[model samples]
Target chain A: MIETDQLTRCYGHLTAVDALSIRVEPGQVLGLLGPNGAGKSTAMRMIAGFLIPTSGTARVCGYDVAREPLKAKRALGYLPEGAPSYGEMTVREFLQFIVRMRGLKADAAYRRFDEVVQRLQLEDVLGLCIDTLSKGLRRRVGLAQAILHDPPVLMLDEPTDGLDPNQKHAVRQLIDTMARERTILISTHLLEEVHALCNRVVIIARGKLLADATPAELEQRSRYHGAVSFSAPGSGMSQEMLGRLPQVASIEVDPLDGRITVFPKVGERILEPVERLLREQGLEVSEIQLERGRLDEVFRQITTQETDGARDAVAGVNA
Target chain B: MSPIAAVMRRELRSYFVTPVAYVFLVIFLVLAGTLTFYAGDFYEREQADLQPFFVMHPWLYLILVPAITMRMWAEEAKGGTLELLLTLPLTLWQAMLGKFLAAWLFIGLALGLTFPIWITVDYLGAPDNGVIAAGYLGSWLMAGTFIAIGACLSALTRSQVVAFILTALVCVLLILAGQPQVLDFFQGALPRKLVHAIAHLSMLQHFDAISRGVLDVRDLLYFLISMIGWLIAGVLLLDLKRTR
Candidate 1:
């Protein structure tokens, strides 16, 4: 439903988005992840037809954003970074204005309006001016406007930024439900949100695409992938002895709890081997488990490595 | 509804929802009343014509029109709603025209409310109603010209104060171009034809021709072309900003 062909946007000496390309299929929720100044918003703006890409092209539902802006915009709804709206307008007034601008028929517009108002729970504040609403409420109002016309594609930048926990959950739920019928591209810094909501994740840094894959696939790149952990009562097996095992690459002992974590060599099956070793070594094992890697750990590794590389590049220039 | 109409409706509703519409109405009516009766000396002249009233419109609008239009695009840029509006399915020209018509209609409403002055003139003596009607048309055209320039300036920055001051300054120059002192500045330094060209560009000169019931096509074309020129410049400026 959305595609970009080497989308590039440069501001003088700094490139905001650099030769970035992406494709989002229908019914896919794509979580765009990056650190500060990572070109996430710039890419989304180009897709939404608000900003012209310095080179290449962005297309939504088969229409080029620059060539056929109106058509591309018709197929997409965008919630910008701050969720700006007409402060003087009431929530209902603002939504209705959008509906009219979208060119919906009267009956269809009002019905859709009522549906979004109820869905976003904006009934009580319908008559209040937008500026008078709290941050969470204002975010919900922004959500309501984006979903009001029920466009087939959605580009949301920080949709859950200011919401309280419950409101954030509500918005995530709404996005989850809407993903069944639309293509969603959401940019956020929250790793957990990406895990919980996105089927596909794309990580970028310094205007370059760094990683793109499923959440599980990205997690597999972590150092802790397929590691094993067990808490035992004073296992007499020394760290050196365990390190001798062919499958066991490293082991960590928690001093206070006397628990041991075993990391396997790449492509090695250590769970069975470690269990057999512990059984033969006279260790009283209370708990043992195999684990998938943590997404947060992998996220930090990937993003920080990129930052360090950027710093090194700057340092190299100085040298 | 068309794109322009939709935008105009929203813009008009926004005007009333804030204090801008009410405050503007009050100030405009008071100024018009005071200027006509006190400064223009309408009753002392003892003529049924509304010459005193119509003559003050350009100067009144020099300040007031910019006040109304300074926020037209500047507020959108500041509040970040310009992104939302542009990303909608409307063309740039459609949005600009919509906003322009909305402000133009608002100025028309303010001009319309001064009907009591027209009634007062009718009651006192036999005034030439044709000339009065022509004067109103002329005033509305001049309002459009001022709004177009203000709209262009508003697109240059996000600060409404800056937009207001700059628009007022430009309109002052445009209105003062025909004054004797201004023409005198060029009298010896430039040729007679060049001075005439400068005077012809003055909004006051064209408006005076129209208000006196001489509805020349040249004056009409002058207002229309200038209005379109400024609006096109405003739209281009907005597009330039979006590229960044």
Candidate 2:
């Protein structure tokens, strides 16, 4: 498990990670979501023992990162931001070096190296110098190094930044296979990644965590009322007057076309009235649909700090 | 032992892979050999001691040691491998000591390749082998001082060029402090005790004394203290940087 008690890192006048207190349990994949410079990297570095927190402390398993650094470091496998593997070494040599540095021995060591190499699909570049590999291949090498020792906690910063779609799927699958045995904390800004891999998400902005919740809960909050949109032909009066009905909560019109989005109050169904109004107005609608709130929608709402404008993490709590 | 030896072995092997180190070793041997034969008048006098070659080592080390130590930490930081290294099980002091010792040994190997001079001098005349041994011991000790200070400076910057230049400037000051001409001015202008104390801090006095077949306890202690002291300072600098 990874836990922090009001952890923060300050550099000169800027606060990188501001009093972040969180708990990441074992066998769970926690996605740390934030924009660039959201203090995600700083928090991960502190947990990895690469950067010391200016205040508070981070613990890995039960060991404090600062006070029991070796034990903390030993419990964690960190792929730092930018994926720093030795450029001078070949893939095989670098993996071997990490194995030794972590104090693993013999059969167990070779097997561990083999497992990471296979999982990361790094066999093709095993003989090439790490610096000579492509960005995607080098990322695999970095992943290989991080998992070489099989530490209980894996702190991966942008683990799939340079990977192709196929490679990305494979890596996500790899993480899924291993999540049952380790606590993985991945810091990425992408919403789909959280939807695809993580069960829980923590949204941080400008050095502070804004929200943390499951993807489904976030999506549920995006809907303030029922919205059902579809194509219909109006034969009578205007569609705008139809919205004047008591059942309508909101009507967001797409000005260029006749497309309209209608939201009613909680537990209210405005679709039947809207459908009847569209028929009476004699209006032809090509397409109409409700906004399906995914993790991306929730992320947008949080990054813009538009709490009132949308819902997810906070909306769920209020509900 | 495992940690130190592990780091030291890799550092020593690195010299063979890079052109700069190979070139350094060849040039060092050539210069040491040429100085022994041409400057010392070895062919004419059949000298027994290695004083001529040893006398020039302090100057040689001023340039060579920095070249060897400059990339120790600076390269690691610049390449972003310092993060990988710092996160390893080894402590900063252990890594620093290992790298410094490895560089020292590489320099020692380059110096040892000039063994033909010892053979030539011993073959021609009855040279005091003990003095030749002492000269080597002193030269190695002197190189230790340069390596220690250079390693400390290496940890101060990410640019190897900056580390090299800083170490070279500090080395020049040490070399000049004990010069006869500098002493003449200091004798007239400064207090005797202060002047002598400053001179004693230099590598020259001890290196020169040891090169001349003397086993001075004070000089040996000076080299030991300065070498270890500078290394300790390097560890402290690393800790301070890490905390900040």
TM-score of chain A of each: 0.90, 0.84
Q: How would you encode candidate 2's per-residue C-alpha lDDT over A112-194 as one tens digit per residue? A: 78878888888788898788898888888888788788888988999889889998898899889889979999999777898
lDDT by residue for model 1 over A1-319, one digit each (tens)?
Answer: 9999999999998999999999999999999999888999999988998889999999999999998899999999899988999989988889889988999999988888999999999999999999999999998998888888899999899999989989989999999999997999999999879977999999998888889999999878877788888887756555567789998888988888877889999999788888888888877788898877788788788888988998999999999
In CAPRI terms, where does candidate 2 land?
medium
Q: After superposition, how far is residue A225 of candidate 1 from its true place, in Å?
A: 1.4
CAPRI classification of candidate 1: high
Candidate 1 residue-wise lDDT at B114: 99
lDDT string, candidate 2, B1-244, tens digits? 3666667766775666567688898888887778767886767765567777887788788888899889998998888888877877677777898899998888888888888888877887788898889899999988988999999999999999999999999998898898888888889889999899878877788888888889999999999998999999998888777657
iRMS of each prediction = 0.8, 2.0
Q: Give the Cα error of residue A42 in candidate 2, in Å.
A: 1.7
TM-scores of the models, in the order given: 0.95, 0.89
Q: Which whole-number lDDT from 0 to 100 does residue A101 have in model 1?
A: 93
